[model samples]
Target: MDYIGWAWLFVIVVCIVIEATTMGLTTIWFGIGAIVAWITSGLGFRLEVQIFVFLVVSILCLVLTRPIAVKKLKIGKIRTNADSIIGECVKVITTINNINNEGTVKARGQIWSARSFNDEVIEKDEIVCVKEITGVRLIVERKK
Candidate 1:
């Protein structure tokens, strides 16, 4: 109904739009806090008090609500296909070249695409450990 109301509504709208695009609760809480400021202003509060309330409430909401929101928004730990092999150990099932690619490893009782981390050919059936996985490819090295 006035300039302060319009300003608060603008902030809320902008924050909501940003949160929509970013898909994070970061701005949404601030927007809600701004709405609270608008309410305070509508209740005949001074601009200073409204701004202070907005800042305090926004910080509090962001600190308190964000963690819960983030925990709920996640889809478990491993979202990508590569993340599935984080803790899996693999054994060398094929020979690896020192200069080329083309290797295989047995991980979790399943054969997966493998490569040498140091370009060393690991013999067939050699004991190798899956150190890290990168985009469906396993970077393996000899165990001993």
Candidate 2:
């Protein structure tokens, strides 16, 4: 209708394009906001009111829906085999000395480079619990 309506339409199109390309569940809310703004412009609302509605609606949509959308879409980190190894008990194949930076452990029938989680020396053949994996190395702690 008016120039403001055309501008709001442009915003909506740009937001939709960005959302499609990224699939990030972010810009779609802005597109929804722009649609409302476009309707406001068509209804002869002032420019300031239209812009304020756009911003408030966009922020509310994002805050309210983003978390639910992420949970439903399973968009966060996916667990892997390495993640599964955390908290597993393994035998130290080599003396674990964080100061020396030399150690290995056997877990799930495979040997992995190891480090002491608390910087304590672990003797070979001792049982240790896998605490975390960093790069190719497993951070371990003495089995209690």
Q: What TM-score goes with each of the models?
A: 0.67, 0.73
Q: Superposing all C-alpha atoms, what RMSD in Å does each candidate have to the true structure?
A: 4.5, 3.1
lDDT of 1 at 38: 93
Which ranges in model 2 have alpha carbons more than 4 Å from their true place?
89-95, 104-113, 123-128, 134-136, 142-144
Residue 59 lDDT in model 1? 95
Flag clash pairs in model 2: none
Task: Please give, for residues 5-102, the per-residue lDDT of candidate 2 as tens digits.
Answer: 99999999999999899888879999999999999999999999999999999999999998999999976556678889999999999999999999
User: What's the lDDT for residue 66 in model 2?
Assistant: 87
RMSD of 2: 3.1
Question: Number of the top candidate by TM-score?
Answer: 2
Candidate 1 C-alpha lDDT tens digits along 58-78: 999989988888888872344
